[model samples]
Target: MKKVILGLSALCMVAFTSCKEDASSKINSENVAAAAERDATSGDFPTITFEETEHDFGTIVNGTPVETKFKYKNTGNSPLVVSNIKSTCGCTVPSDWNREPLAPGESAEFTVKFNGKGKGAVTKSITLTTNTEKGSEVVKIKSFVEADPNAPAKTPAKPVIKQVQ
Candidate 1:
């Protein structure tokens, strides 16, 4: 589906981009898998790597639904387990995840669908519970929703005039 392709594209981008400092900072599938083997021989070491932690939905029409994907990979040696994903509130909801134990170098994505029913600047966060060192990670989504132009407007009623015969 579209979501699958988008996730794959994100994975590819992360694999291709250059890291700024540590090798972990720039995780590629090739190195991640290699490290996984080393970890298996040594001990269990699970790490989570997100291609991008934040997503901006920009401007959206009021009462409309907007969405985006937060892509991640297990760069650790052990299988990465995502226990749960909690959203800040109902306005933003996580639609899907791979669910199974994510093997090292294997990629997955969490898709969030946001309802822009309230007209104003909106920000939401998703808390991911994983078996990583920190045990949790936060991903953010933001947007500015414009008023719905097609919404019906209220009009004042005309005053009744009294006639005297």
Candidate 2:
């Protein structure tokens, strides 16, 4: 008789634990659904679309400053706000983008200036922080800096012709 009672107690405990777990899972699901509903009723998200993510400066003169602009637009359902812009190195600088929120279908451009300090094949990246769904965007600029071909050639001073033959 005692064994039967113990078995019954064990069964009851198992059932109670399972019910508790189910209730907790249901609550979690309900919370998730509620959050989704709230998001649906709230403002929509913004997306950034660029005409081109990369720009080529072509061949540039070393030691000169060159700038290129990257065009973009807000293609999502909401307005887009630019939060930050950063360059990969100190020699490269990025100009301020549209400070105001860009409404959908509006277009703008961000300018990047790279001091033509490096030579040979050069590549730089500019990172943009925005209210985009992915949170960030990256733009690339590449150039081949050629040594100034117009630099004057050095001429050796004419050897002094000794007259004291």
Candidate 3:
């Protein structure tokens, strides 16, 4: 029995040794140089400087759509790449923006449309995913939606009463 156990252990050791790989074999000179270059320029990150981070549409009628332009500039040493723009809700839509990489000191603008569907003091945010130092940035839109005079009046819900058993 001890001989059988020793033979099994030896077999397992051989299998593991054969499966082992040399970590240095996967790395090459080109890969090392690329990694070094990336590390050396890691501090050079693009920055987004918005002319106005927030915009207020003032008083607007409910159900009316409104739009505004948000201007920005690249104020860093690296190029700025805005990969995506997302809104907090479907009622707000963003469009008409530059899709190319913005060089340092270049300016760009995007349009944001808000479908005035909320009540008073409505606020929404649009997030931009970029290659900036912070990776992402946020802009806000606000408005006071007044009730439309022509809108149909909402009927009050009827109360339900439950009888005691």
Candidate 4:
């Protein structure tokens, strides 16, 4: 009779332990799924990564138009969408990029135009809006412009034929 009671107690303990393990496993699974969902919808959807960070336009003569292009890839797993782009000054113009939802393997370009009206070293920036965690991005375009000094002397050394005889 005592043996029978001991055997039944052992079986009950085993069954209870198994049930507790299963319940804990379910809870852990739920937590994992919740974490994944939170990561996905945390408003940090995609990323915009560029191949080149800095661009130099070299030297441009005054009153000329100079432009440069920036290439980039959507390095993240999700699609990258670029919204609005703004230039820091009126002398700098950024061509609008109408392409949307750049896939993980795709690429894009942003063209920046700088009017060589200003003298000395010019530094400008273009701001981009997107669905990234940072919400926006900025790219810099720079150049050195100098006024042309030889543009005014055309007929100075034409003919000095007066006292040759």
Query: Candidate order by TM-score, highest to lowest?
Result: 3, 2, 1, 4
Residue 48 miss distance in model 2 (angstroms): 0.9
Against the true structure, candidate 4 has what lDDT? Answer: 0.82
Q: Score candidate 1 by lDDT.
A: 0.88
Which candidate wins on lDDT? 3
> Clashes in model 4: which pairs?
none
List the candidate 1 regions with Cα displacement exceeding 4 Å. 1-44, 154-165
lDDT at residue 113 of model 1 (Cα atoms): 92
The residue-by-residue lDDT of candidate 4 on 67-148, one tens digit each, is 8888888877778888888888999888858557888878899888888777899888888888787888888987888887
The C-alpha lDDT values of all candidates are: 0.88, 0.88, 0.96, 0.82
| lDDT (Cα) of model 2 | 0.88
RMSD of each: 21.6, 9.7, 3.1, 16.5
lDDT of 1 by residue, 1-165 (tens): 999999999999998785557766677889889988877666565899999898988999998898889999999988999989989899889968877999999999989999886668888889999988788999999999998889887699999999999
The 10-residue segment with the lowest total lDDT in model 3: 19-28
Better of 2 and 4 by TM-score: 2
Model 3 whole-model lDDT (C-alpha atoms): 0.96
Which stretches in model 3 have alpha-carbon errors above 4 Å? 12-26, 152-165
